[model samples]
Target chain A: DAGITQSPRYKITETGRQVTLMCHQTWSHSYMFWYRQDLGHGLRLIYYSAAADITDKGEVPDGYVVSRSKTENFPLTLESATRSQTSVYFCASSESLWSSGSPLHFGNGTRLTVT
Target chain B: GIQVEQSPPDLILQEGANSTLRCNFSDSVNNLQWFHQNPWGQLINLFYIPSGTKQNGRLSATTVATERYSLLYISSSQTTDSGVYFCAGALYNQGGKLIFGQGTELSVKP
Candidate 1:
């Protein structure tokens, strides 16, 4: 309840269907990020939000979309799920942008499978 | 874009042993962090050492920004330490985007 939480721990969706992964944090961090992990590629950033209404693309933002309407929530959306999009999605948050030596707190992650 | 590389892609050790993991970067970094992903798939922050050395409990980390590398050391390993260890780096002007390494999978057998 005091940390970051991800919903739908596991999800299975068919191709061409839209799926959204939810992330919520109680700390009200200013920076929120979405990352996808695969076997050979480690963790690749999908998107990150500096604050409410300010978002930017990361290393891998091709098919994923993200929005942060509030400081406590950042949601990632897959417009049309594809098999290649199957991976473990993680959500992380930081208190500030300055390198105050603060670490990113991560959620348990959501496993998404596209069939 | 910066590139991150980790050494010893996989490792296995008995309980009470010690191990070291290394992370190398292709360019300068403004921030560096080490994370421990437990067997249950929970990513826990181990350290946020951009430079110099810091120790906590049985874990310690050192980052040489000038050399563009970082090292994580685990002492008295336990079965609970079994998981993947990742190192992420952020460039100075990259807007705090983290580029993660492939990670080292460590298994500690009791």
Candidate 2:
């Protein structure tokens, strides 16, 4: 596929366990982001990668780790999953950082539940 | 952090009716985008209007950067339009990270 794809469409893990969500994009976009969606909060950014090895934290980066070893792959890891961390996760990519014409393309999303 | 608020959190419209959703941001933004999250939880890009106006099919969006707000207009609504509409804005020096509003949930009944 030419667009972004997220793995394990749905996941359920126990608290204190580690879980990794994978995101892959074929467009080779320079910017990749991970967001978690909750009821009142629309989408809160967990982490983002500017390039292959450059990454930064977003609004909500606590307890979540992200790494981008390659331009096409950006994975989000939860070192210790908690019930509060159970939410739908979305992976997005863009060509430019803050350009007007560059809009984000989101994946189908991964629904994670921590019990 | 900038605040992003959306109006009319929930809306129900009949097919063929028209509706408008509004998004307000607390600060100036360099990027503004409208997205439609379908029932399957897929976020589809609706418009990438930082300023000015753009139309695609029966959907159109207008963003007035100076006013710090954006409007998404959905015309001739269809059942397929039922979903959550979100607007995200990025500040000038935020490294392209966007802050999203709560979103407007629309249900189109046929």
Candidate 3:
């Protein structure tokens, strides 16, 4: 497809288990981001990648790891999934840093539940 | 870090009515965007208006960076417009870090 896609739209894992959320974009955007959405919190950024091999933490990065080995893919890993991490995860991509009229395109999102 | 706040946490309107959503920021921002999270949990970009105004179909947005706020207007609301509207801003020195507001949840009834 020509848009961003997320894998395992729904996932249920036990606490302390490891889970990985995959995000792939066909546009080859330079900037990719992962966000978690809960009831009161609209969306909190967990991690973002500027380009291949360059990533940084966002507002909420604890217990999460992200890697961008290619321009088209960015994956988020939860080393030890906790019940607190049970939320909807969204992946988005932009052509560049936000200065150049680049609006983020988001995937359908992954709903993860930790029990 | 910049703080973002949105007004009217929840709203319900009859179809064909009009509504407006507002976003306030604590500091200067270099990037501002509006998104609509559909009922299916898909976030669709509505606008990337860091400044000035832009319109698309029944939706329009205006960002007054000097005022540290933005407004999104939905004209003749439809059932499809029922969703969570979010506004996000990125600070000047920050490396593409977006701070999202609490969001306005809108429900358009027929």
Best by DockQ: 3
Shift of residue B70 alpha carbon in model 3, Å: 0.1
Q: What is the clash count for each candidate, in the order shown?
A: 0, 0, 0
Candidate 2 DockQ vs. native = 0.73
| Candidate 1 structure quality by residue, lDDT tens digits, B7-72 | 999999999999999999999788899999988888998998888999999999999999999999
lDDT of 1 at A42: 89
Candidate 2 interface RMSD after superposing interface residues: 1.4
Which lDDT values do the candidates have, in the order given?
0.92, 0.92, 0.93
Model 3's CAPRI class? medium
Model 1 chain A poorest 10 in a row by lDDT: A95-104
lDDT of 3 by residue, B1-110 (tens): 89999999999999999999999999878899999989988888899898999999999999999999999999999999999999999976898798899999999999
Model 2 DockQ class: medium
Q: Model 1 in CAPRI terms: which quality? A: medium
Residue-level lDDT of model 2, residues A17-79, one tens digit each, is 999999999998999999999998999988988899999999999999999889999999999
lDDT for A57 (candidate 2): 90
